[model samples]
Target: MTSEVRAAVFRPDDERIADAVDLLESLGATPVPDPMLAVEPTGATPAPADWTVLTSKTGVELAAEAGWTPTDTRLACIGPATADAARAEGWAVDVVPEEYSSAGLVDALTAAVATDESVGVARSDHGSAVLLDGLREAGIETTETVLYRLVRPVDAGESTARAAAGELEAALFTSSLTVEHFLDAAAERGVRAAAVEGLADAVVGCIGEPTAATARDHGITVDVVPDEATFEALATAVVERAAPSHHGE
Candidate 1:
């Protein structure tokens, strides 16, 4: 490769960075682990429901870790990967939103399922209230639980230094928290403006539109987003889109 073309892997704790790192490496860019967020168990027991919703793979993993075995509850996941995670835990997914966002999930469930059923949502401690709010607006009662905790790692803006040096060529954002904390960390390091410019200049990829919205709200341009919110697909999309920039050299 003509340039190192480092891409920031901005997911939480590098939990799912391997596949994306491999993909970026195959495309001739070195993947830098920029784990800006960390997750911890909240120790809060999740309530049961006739319909249960999971927004992230972490939620599914943590729920299963907490010995939450699905009884007769119908599972609704926010993305295909999340559905896969739910299935891996032995529960069949009843609904997955085609748009893969809060409003989309609520829309999908509103049209397809009976609204009177008891619904529950499991997510991280800082998970958005969007889905729960949207569902309630749609007349569906949802009990929400913080199944895990999300925290900004103390080293959040470690990569913003690279960013200031113009070394962050691209990045992948998996959640709103990642985008939020990445900026928070960058701002914490007193390079928020430079980091914002650098991110704007870099090829920004999001696993879903919700995250893209977060980036745009912060004035960062989003270059790639996958139809399916899977890490492999997002990584591939970013690489494919970055090819003409000589990233695959």
Candidate 2:
């Protein structure tokens, strides 16, 4: 049997979905695109700050949408891809920690900032508060701005849900919102049980511990979690899991 990967990409952009698809193909697995959420910028005004932290590429896109410029402030990114996105927007990246997480960014910022430097965080409305809390505890002035919001897709086709049920051998979740959106889409298609159980059997992969925890909360066991929470790392984990020895050759 050909190794087929059922991927649940919550990213709204086709390019993002294509990245997942390419990963699956490279592993000799057929990819099935089943996006569960759509990302939209909140149109919030950017305030002046000494430093700006970007947690996601979507957040970077939102900052661009709001006409924010890096020339006016320092930029810190949670991961290299986010940093690259910021750089693409002509922003200078001041810091990108070795570990790719908001907490990691906070730790890096804590070490770099003076006692009086005010930092602004651009992130989703719903996300972990670990970064904000850590920054505040470290005496760094932190202001969180909601940049983008994830909305569950209203038009999930039944065929996609059925694919999630019967054909997808593995599902990759990148965030908590992806998990929630997958559950919501599955429930809407009346395949909640199938979706959950199928994911449990399949090689469910997560980008980080937080996303893995979210999968666990939904009774979906994460079979693979990469060391770094980057797209490249996540793709590597998926490929490794699908390898013959890893899957019991």
Candidate 3:
């Protein structure tokens, strides 16, 4: 008899988690929906600048909700997903980095904009410093607006316990912050070491290179990082690798 393939997902506690669960079920894996991240809006908007950069879909949504528009500023997104989100709000997206990361954004902007222009970055409080540092090093004046803060939810340790108990067949990590929150939850439950041990035996997948590096730095063995840094890609790759074991094939 085949055992159920239980996979853990660490998205925010929102519709994204529901979408992830549906995707996992369609892929034949039992979804372990543990929301390790929570969004706390800072109620601030980006100041007008020569160039404006947005990093996440959530930032775009928050900005739109606050009635902030990129009227005259040239807009650049860190990835296609954020660009799509901005476009959905009737904003003209001028540039989307080909690489879909902080470094990618820096490269795209540096090549497109002059050093004399100022850049405004609007993202989460946990936004990576690579983009700002790279832009500044290129002699472009840059400022950041914290659109929101990502905090771990209070009731987020179920997956940590499951992983430590050797019940999860796979784990999907979306960002470096999610990885950190998972470890924090595990440590809170006193299962940090055991959970890392269990992850060694399971297929662990991160959305991108930076997230994979964060997992590796914390002693977790990462098994898959897809070319596209998207949740669909991460979950698909992880389920494909973990399904064989659950099916006893």
**What would the per-residue lDDT of candidate 2 be over residues 171-208, giving only the tens digit for each residue?**
67788877887787777778888778766666778888
Encode model 1's per-residue lDDT on 1-249: one tens digit a residue.
334567888776654766667777887777888787788888765587888888888888888887887786888898888899889888888899888777788888887668568788888777677788888888887899888888888866777877776777788888888888888888788888888788776778998888889989998899998987777788888766665454534
Candidate with maximal TM-score: 3
Each prediction's TM-score versus the true structure: 0.89, 0.91, 0.96
Itemize residue pairs with steric clashes in candidate 1.
none
> Which regions in candidate 2 have their CA more than 4 angstroms from the true location?
157-160
Which residue ranges in model 1 land beyond 4 Å of their true spot? 1-3, 244-249
Q: Give all candidates' CA lDDT scores.
A: 0.80, 0.76, 0.92
The regions of model 3 sitting more than 4 angstroms off are 245-248
TM-score-superior candidate, 1 or 3: 3
Q: Pick the candidate with the highest lDDT.
A: 3
Q: Which pairs clash (backbone N, Cα, C closer than 3 Å) in model 3? A: none
What's the ranking of the predictions by lDDT, best on top? 3, 1, 2
TM-score of 1: 0.89
State model 1's lDDT: 0.80
